[model samples]
Target: MSESLTIVGIAGSLRAQSYNRQLLAAAGELLPNDVRFILADISNVPLYNEDLESALPEAVVTLKQTVESADGVIFATPEYNGSIPGVLKNVIDWLTRPRGQSSLNGKPAGIIGGTTGMFGAVNAQMHLRHILPLLNMYVIPQPLVLISQIQNKLDAAGHLTDETSQKFLQQHLDRLVSVARRMKNEQ
Candidate 1:
């Protein structure tokens, strides 16, 4: 049998009770046995700075290494002022630095979002879809997940409790795994 596919998952929210983080946790539980989803900790990643890029802070180095080692990436984000949160953008800046040789180059990426608002995180996901291509990432085209009313989908413990939401999340994971597998072979 072929080796299991590894995906590095990043939650774009730092709040202790963030719905985006809860969505990521649900995704981790729903991934298939052939796919491994590991959540990358973004809590320690410092704000991006050109001077720090020379030495590359430990957290930044770790984030890059985690992304580079994974077959694909899954971003669970929240919209902030109609775009990605500042912390998430900071991490992306660090990952895309040095111009041409970004760690995310040519890698397949799946983006999903959870928000309390009725629009979910549609704007943020749309913006990321445009930005990722510039970073050389092959963003998946299908099974886009924008979880609205997220507070009702998961429990206080961060587990997915809604049947409909679980099914939707599973579908997203399936698509991500399939696309990542195909991209892996293409590379």
Candidate 2:
């Protein structure tokens, strides 16, 4: 609470105009003025290769430091074949890292997503809820935001335009920041 809270967002999809990416891009607008939202870049990260961890790629190091520094993380994922995207999973693998120490350990995380499908990305979010805890992250359990039929919600420029969805996303970010603040204060 004493310092400005920094919450980072990582979109699992690499497509420039993907719904998840647009959602993450618009997250800052819905957050409190004091809270900072950073959209993490995962494009340069190579596929998960254990052989490369000994020296860690430059992009990997950058991402690890970014995640380690933030008070909280929001994973905007797109469900691919009923599960989380491989790119996002690859990034997590990088974060879990060299040993018992992980950047994600004990950090607060929130899951959110949008999709054209009727069910949204619920399966992806659920998968993340189960996986993140194993790495020691605190995943937010309430006020789920599974935005379905995202094409109708975002404008041509990819910004979220629906007032109702805006309010909901705002609430979700607020809660994520609340949990992050609590954890930081406790520490």
Q: What is the C-alpha lDDT profile of model 2 across 16-81, one tens digit per residue?
A: 788998998888777788888889999999998989978999999999999999999999998899
The clash count for each model shown is: 0, 0
Best by TM-score: 2
lDDT of each: 0.85, 0.89
Tell me the tens digit of each residue's lDDT in model 1 across 1-187: 7568999988899888888878887888788788878889889999988887668899888889999999999898899999998999888998987566498988888898888888879999998999899898888776778888888877878897877767777887888888888888877
Query: Candidate 2 at residue 170, lDDT?
Result: 81
TM-score of each: 0.94, 0.96
Give the residue spans of candidate 2 off by over 4 A.
none
Cα deviation of 43 in candidate 2 (Å)? 0.2
Candidate 2 colliding pairs: none
Candidate 1 lDDT score relative to the true structure: 0.85
